[model samples]
Target: MSRTSHICLMAEYNEWMNARLYEAAINLPIEKLNANRKAFFGSILGTLNHLVVADTIWLKRFAAHPANYVALDMIRDLPTPTSLDQMLFTDIQSLSEHRKSLDQAIIEWVHSIDEHDLDYVLSYSNMKGIPAQKNFFSLVMHFFNHQTHHRGQATTLLSQAGVDVGVTDLLALIPNETVA
Candidate 1:
């Protein structure tokens, strides 16, 4: 598969996983959901928030909307999720919708992106004032990876909160790709 196509498939899988994650968190009790389990991103809410923020930033960047964050601002604002379960529910819904939008964007880009494009470096300075450059494909992969890492942290915090989330794996999403 082409690199962009591969990432789109992964994004589809990620969207599938978000549904399960949202279901698991729906009735987790507001108090427990908001409680700090000291996960990698600090709290459950924080980790979720971080994932959402990354997605938002990437969406903006992809659309060629001017970038809005600096490295330090990003560092300080990582994963600032809300404590309320209801609000979190809304955020998850928004995330799912945004995933759809992003998938469409990727499809459009992949129709034209080629081996030469992959070699062309895109440069931007992160919040730390450090310049970074990588192939566009690498940057897209990093975007998804950043979400996965924090989701792992959030899942850990979920476990510590005694929330029994059955099967966090991507294969579990839309089983067989038919009924999912």
Candidate 2:
């Protein structure tokens, strides 16, 4: 697959997995969602919130790209997360709504960019104010990989709480190919 096609696929997978996770998460009581499970982010809600925070931070940075992606314009208005663990929404319902919006924006943004845009070396500062320049494509990969990594943590946490997120695999979203 082409680079843009791959990115578009990842974006779709992101939305798909998030919908499943949130649907499962919403079935739990608020207390259960907030309960600290000793996971990296503390709880299911916390881990999910971290994903939103991190995605917001990255999306804001991406909005500054020279291509001027219209889909990311909404991200520019979002509050910059001060920490990775910052909770944007205290409850699953509110968080799920925002996640849907963000996922849609991500899908639009990926579809808006072509392979040429991915070659640009994006310059941005890290959360610690450290300056760095890196390839945009690699950064986008990190963006999706980061989500998958934390979502795995969330799935495990949910499973412990007896809420299975079912089929948390990117392979499930890949289309079957037919030989010509």
Candidate 3:
């Protein structure tokens, strides 16, 4: 496949892993889910919420939307999106639906941008009002990396909470149906 196709696949797989993590998270009690037991980021709920926000902000960035630093702070205030008792019945139903919608939207936006657009420099003044130069391609890569980094933190919170979220390895995305 082409470079864009490869990127799309990677992004799709990342989205899938994130969906699975959300599934594993809601299996526990609300007290456990919201517990201040996470070793970092204070609470498991808060940390997962951060991942959701990061994805949203990066999705905006990837789409070449206005880069607003203020939205980054809005993650914590977004509310507990998962229902605990309902999760026993719903599993990851709600979270999976949202993730699927977001993932599809990302893929579509990426398809709209040509490879030439990747090199175009996007100059924007930061919250400090200082001008900064970030290549669209480089920033896009950072967006994906940011998702992986924060999701890892959420994974840690899950593990600490005694959740066995099996198999985060990327190679697992390829099944017996070989890519080659």
Most TM-score-accurate candidate = 2
> What's model 3's lDDT at 106?
62
Off by over 4 Å in 1: 65-117, 171-180
**In candidate 1, how many Å is residue 174 off?**
11
TM-score of 3: 0.70
Q: What is the TM-score of each candidate against the true structure?
A: 0.66, 0.98, 0.70
Candidate 3 colliding pairs: none
Per-residue lDDT value at 48 in model 3: 61
lDDT tens per residue, model 1, 154-176: 77777888776667675654335
List clashing residue pairs in candidate 1. Answer: 50-79, 70-127, 71-126, 71-127, 71-128, 72-127, 174-180
Encode model 2's per-residue lDDT on 1-180: one tens digit a residue: 999999999999999999999999998998889899999999999999999999999999999899999999899988899999998899898899999999999999999998899999999999999999999999999999999999999999999899878898899989999999
Measured by C-alpha RMSD in angstroms, how accurate is candidate 1?
A: 7.7
After superposition of all CA atoms, the RMSD between model 2 and the true structure is 0.7
Model 2 regions more than 4 Å off: none
Greater-TM-score candidate between 1 and 2: 2
| Every candidate's lDDT | 0.57, 0.95, 0.62
Q: Deviation in angstroms for 130 in model 3? A: 4.8
Model 2 lDDT, residue 108, Cα:
95
lDDT of 3 by residue, 71-149 (tens): 2333323343332112212223455566666566665565565666667777755434577788887777776777777
Candidates sorted by lDDT, descending order? 2, 3, 1
